[model samples]
Target: MWLTSKIKQLLMVMKPGVVTLNYPAERPPVPKNLRGQPVWDHQKCIGCGGCSDHCPSRCILTRDVCQELRVMLYDGSRCTYCGRCADICPEGAITMSNSFEIACDDKDDITTRLELFMMTCQRCGRCYEMEKSNAIDRINLKGFRYDNLEQRALVRTTSETFSPELLKESDNYKRPSDKE
Candidate 1:
């Protein structure tokens, strides 16, 4: 029985080398659903903060509130690749790429930072305003921020008091001044 078990074990361990991967020589093909590392998709991302909100590890950080917040900061050491952030992203912006070779000697060197453009909601079919764009541009230019006003260019108080639902969602809604 001992001889038979040993033979079976050897056969199982060396069965024609069905595995294709050879370490230090070649790498195996990445599976489609394999969540290796987090990467931001600039165009597809809506900058909704969903991924940041859902991230269990809190490795992802963004400065832009909407359109400009598309920039992302990632700390590879802090990220456990839990896949929660990717799953919660509504726009499919966050995804896991097959980039596992992320060994780094310095901790700070492993941190990655990026900028992203914010998506906007429009009223008259015109691109409205972005919160962090002007501010970031100025900061990238100037030395300091003055009362965060530099970042306040994107704020809109909406002087028009009209209900947005009437203009946008309701097909039958006509301006109150207009009637049959």
Candidate 2:
């Protein structure tokens, strides 16, 4: 009885023989709608900070360097690839590419940085006002942001105008410790 059962098990295993592929040398076809990685189109992006705000993993970050310059950074190391940034983009600037093999030693290899030149109002140092009709544009940060890209930290603080005090505070931001 034991011999018969062993033979049956061997036959069952042999039925689905050699289903594994020779990976690294041979690649399989990518399936449809695979959310592998996020790609950004700098031309289409309006520096609205919408993607940064909507990112579930908080991998996308935005920093207003000055009144006329806004820097956006996307750190793929922390990204969950949920495709929220692509969907929330009003200008269709963000897209999910179908390249899934992203194993890398350096995090900078997957990091994306965008330096956008913004048009500011002469009277007020703020960015050019957007029309109120579009709700997507309204969901962005109104003032200045100072995210720490080197530390990969999102400083959840903003000011109506560029403030050096706020920038200094962000620089000193430290994560809470569990030891306390």
Top model number, lDDT: 2
What's the lDDT for residue 98 in model 2? 98
- Candidate 1 residue-wise lDDT, 65-165, digit = tens: 23223345666787898887777666677788887777889966766555655433455221222243444222121111111121211111221223344
Provide the lowest-lDDT 10-residue window in model 1: 139-148
Q: Candidate 1: where is the Cα deviation over 4 Å?
A: 1-22, 64-71, 106-110, 117-180
- Note the residue pairs that clash in candidate 2: none
- What would you estimate as the lDDT of candidate 2? 0.83
lDDT by residue for model 2 (1-180), tens: 999999999999999999889897998889879998899999999887878877878988888877788889999999999998897787889999999999899989999999999876566455334443566545555578899877778888888888888877787777777986
For candidate 1, give the lDDT of residue 96: 84
Candidate 2 ranges beyond 4 A from true positions: 1-4, 121-141, 177-180
Alpha carbon lDDT of each predicted model = 0.51, 0.83
Extract clashing residue pairs from model 1.
64-69, 67-117, 67-118, 67-119, 68-118, 70-116, 71-115, 71-116
Candidates in order: C-alpha RMSD to true structure: 16.7, 3.5
